[model samples]
Target: MAELWKSLPSWVRNIVVPVLVLVLAWNIVTFVFGVVGALLAMLVKLLVVVGIAAAVVILVKKAAKS
Candidate 1:
């Protein structure tokens, strides 16, 4: 394999090989970013829910005291 790769011209080794690798990996990169974005969005939603629940508890406590 190394011999076959070495047999190729320098332009194919330097530029074409890297470009093909990136093109092949592009879908994988996009999938990873999409998963991360979804996770972050879910985390934000959880935080918002917790905040609202806390506020309701506080309001209930205040009403009970009064």
Candidate 2:
């Protein structure tokens, strides 16, 4: 494997390899960010639902007291 790598042209070893590494890293980062974004969206939705439920309960309690 070392012999095979050493046989490659200088451009492939330097430029192409770095570019490929960057592309792979970018893809991994994008995927992780997408997952985090999805989780955050779900959390926000859950919070909104809980907020609305709480508001309803408060209104009902207030009405009962009146």
Clashing pairs in 2: none
> TM-score of model 2 relative to the true fold?
0.80
Per-model TM-score on C-alpha atoms: 0.68, 0.80
Assess candidate 2 and give its lDDT.
0.99
How many clashing pairs in candidate 1?
Answer: 0
Question: Using lDDT as the measure, which candidate wins?
Answer: 2
1-66, model 1: which lDDT tens digit per residue?
Answer: 999999999999999999999987998899999999999999999999999999999999999999
Could you tell me the lDDT of residue 41 within candidate 2? 100
- Model 1 regions more than 4 Å off: 1-20
Clashes of each: 0, 0
Report the lDDT tens digits of candidate 2 across residue range 1-66.
999999999999999999999999999999999999999999999999999999999999999999
